[model samples]
Target: MTTGTIREIDSASVDADGMLSRTMRILGCFTADEPELSASRLGALTGLSSSTLHRILAQMLDLGLLSRTPGRRYAVGVRLWELGELSPLALRLRETALPYMTRLYEATGENVHLAVLDAPAPERATALYVGRLTGRGSIPTLSRMGGRQPLHTTGVGKALLAMQSGDWIDRFLAQPLERETMYSITEPDAIRMEIDRARARGYATTREEMTLGNVSVAAPVGSIAGLPPAALGVVTRIDGADTRRLGALVTQTAADLGRALRAL
Candidate 1:
């Protein structure tokens, strides 16, 4: 393993023999960009020795926590997905929000997105996409159901960020903002301005910040007692798109969904 990987391993493996920690560390090696990895690659990335790595991999594979691909690479298994679907975020939130999201898509025929904050702490949070709807004519997006994105770059992310307290925002912004595109707002003050505008207008917008040639408008669903903070968004080609109109529609849809959730 590389020296950097060794150092990371040392730092993370304080409970070196803890099965839960080791399993989680192994799972963390998978990502959207690299969904599948060979045993050797897993050993290198996780800094687990070959023997230990193989042992864990064998157990995970047997338990259906992982699946082997045709090329002898491992991917997250359907069993994990089965477990995720049972979470309240999936059962209660997404199930309640889908009808409103479907109506929004029918109204605009655009890409509709639903995302939730992954952690209560702003500094550690990311926007986790839970549901998505898109038509053939809709502009493509990098976001996928079950994927995670930075809280500063996407419309749904910004909408969720706008709901946070000033101190929470400050703590979140203290971290280095990722620049997904040249147009992405990385400066803290500028992002704060965006958040202010979003709070005042009841929605947020991103102009080719996450992806080129696309713009998004979104609004938060407000907080529900049993649910993580969530938001709704629509993405479309920037050309001839009216952000204000879309913003209004998104804000209303998010509100409707929030009320529905509360009544349940």
Candidate 2:
């Protein structure tokens, strides 16, 4: 319950030892890790009677907070996502950067991405918007807007990761690094060495590490001192791309974005 608010009689929350309580308990099972649930598993986890859970589920169904998956289990709803889009920072960034990203796309005809750190869990930075060139077919990019990618084997991910601390770095390498492609880096020591290099160089690269026949150049963008909003990168086809040229361009764009973010 929110503090300092007057308690109302018959509030939406009440003693849940019965059907209503059990239903709310079941609904609470959904997390970012556990985005969906079977009614039986939910009932057991929540210690709700099967009959009560079925009834409470009907209420959630009415509210559109949960929907049936292909496997016929309940999961988070699109409506909840719609609400998150209303967040001020999220809505403002997209509006401000859309034109610039579009202009970059038009000029380069490559894949452009916008990313932001999950401030609370900075290790798992987020990709917010990915812009693809409309006219030309770019190299197949592994990154998608609104999807999560790794900070080790990806251009933007490593760039985003480079801005963080040694503690965060150590935690990241603790996991078995995923191999997106044969070129992906897996050795923890090597990745740490590269992160140090990236911090000094101010950019990162993925040469078919995330996808075959694809390569990318990435740089940090408009990151706050303690928090990086995102790393912006352009992914292009591998052939005929000059490493110096791509790195310079990405670094300049990132600097421009960093300045813009500071103003905001």
Candidate 3:
């Protein structure tokens, strides 16, 4: 949305429901870049009156929905973990697939991961990445287990892009791609070419496109029981990298994981 329109909506929600507005604002404080927030930062973020923010935070803390950090910063709590653990989909799938992903990591000696496009859910732009593993001296990466990444940039991100319908692909490309790193692809045409390559080869690769000096390969693991296809993959350094060979490994790993998902 336009900056003005988003600002207006943010102001309008304040009048909608005092409690609900504060709750969403609290959650909004955590960004893709920042997973933790101090109460003062949250206050500045939501622009809610401090009294209201404090009360809401207190309630969330008492309920275990939020956890208090060393200096009163708030982070998603173990209660989220407890509640999420109750969801059979998240719990069972991650538990089932971790061993296989671990094996992939041990064998390839690269960061292994699993993720899916949010085709089934429209209200949120989400990627359900089940795992992320990094080794000592591995290239620094921002992706995390169960964390979300933009669909335009990362290896897992491009895998999501490749599975899109032609219309969806067109619409996605019609927008601007953000420049996260000097190596990231900011042009729509380049992303389109990469997506085409991913489609042809059954895997995706990025060379510092998401993070500098880090190269990653991702392969699609198609869905089971109507779920979106998942991306299972690995990440490594660009030095001495053979991207095509890495792509081959990712494709094989993704296929094996897809079979495991279907069997479960």
Candidate 4:
């Protein structure tokens, strides 16, 4: 079907849910690209009447979901971020892994990351970054707390995907994967091979895949017999460092974090 047709169906479905869906749509319109929006812009984007938009915006403001800026534009409030932080899986994983992540950063003087699988979607699997620790003067990274990245392009994403069932991995690999850098592996077979390597070695490594100058090593954070809730990774610049050795270190950290998570 055409994109317009799909959007119409989505709109109809949202309309079926009445005010709750409308409120959600309004909130959804604010994204990383457009963090702040005026009421008229919100009305235009959501296709809601100006009166209805204002009414909903006012309610959202009162409920602490949206805040009005000094410029009279609206942005997502800290209250909403706090509510997102309350997700049991993300919360517990972040809490359990932060100390280990910090230790990894301190030991390596790099960027340490903790990420969990985002909720399943029909199109593709993605990882939601839940925690991060950057050592002083560490290489800059695009990942941040609460950011999402594709499962096929990141070391942590590959590590998490490596632990999934074979059929699930096959289905996930069938999706169109984005090539974030020249070195990114776009072929499903290549990605599957990488997953296999991660499973055999108990860790994953990506060499300039997600970012041009960044190399990452990651390990899954869970029991050997169960699906992992998250992955732990460290990123560094590609400068002839021993990535295999780094992988081993990250694997040990992941194992420690996995034990802690199991205890929780």
Per-residue accuracy of model 4 over 1-264 as CA lDDT, tens digit each: 111122333545666657866877787777557889988889888899888888888899998988989788999877886787776654677776778988898789999998877644425567878789986688988897767787788989999888788888777876788888899999989988999999999998898889888899999986523333688998999997678889888999999988877776
Q: Pairing residues by index, what is the TM-score of model 4?
A: 0.90
- In the order shown, what is each candidate's alpha-carbon RMSD? 3.9, 7.1, 4.4, 4.2
* Number of the candidate with higher TM-score, 2 or 3: 3
Native-to-model Cα distance after best TM-score fit, residue 143 in candidate 2, in Å: 2.5
The window of 10 residues in a row where model 3 has the poorest summed lDDT is 1-10
Top lDDT prediction, candidate number: 1
Winner on TM-score (1 vs 2) = 1
Give per-model TM-scores: 0.91, 0.71, 0.83, 0.90
**Could you give me the TM-score of model 3 versus the true structure?**
0.83
Deviation (Å) of 138 in candidate 3? 2.8
lDDT of 3 at 87: 55
| Model 1 local distance difference test score | 0.88
lDDT of each: 0.88, 0.67, 0.72, 0.80
Pairs of residues clashing in candidate 3: none
How should the candidates be ordered by TM-score, best one leading? 1, 4, 3, 2
For candidate 3, lDDT tens digit of each residue in 1-264?
011112224535476655664575577666546668887898888887889889998998898878978775788877866886755446656666687788777877877877767543232344556567768756667877656677767788788777777777776666666788887887878888989999998988888777788888887777676466567778888899888787777787777877877887
lDDT of model 1 at position 226 = 82
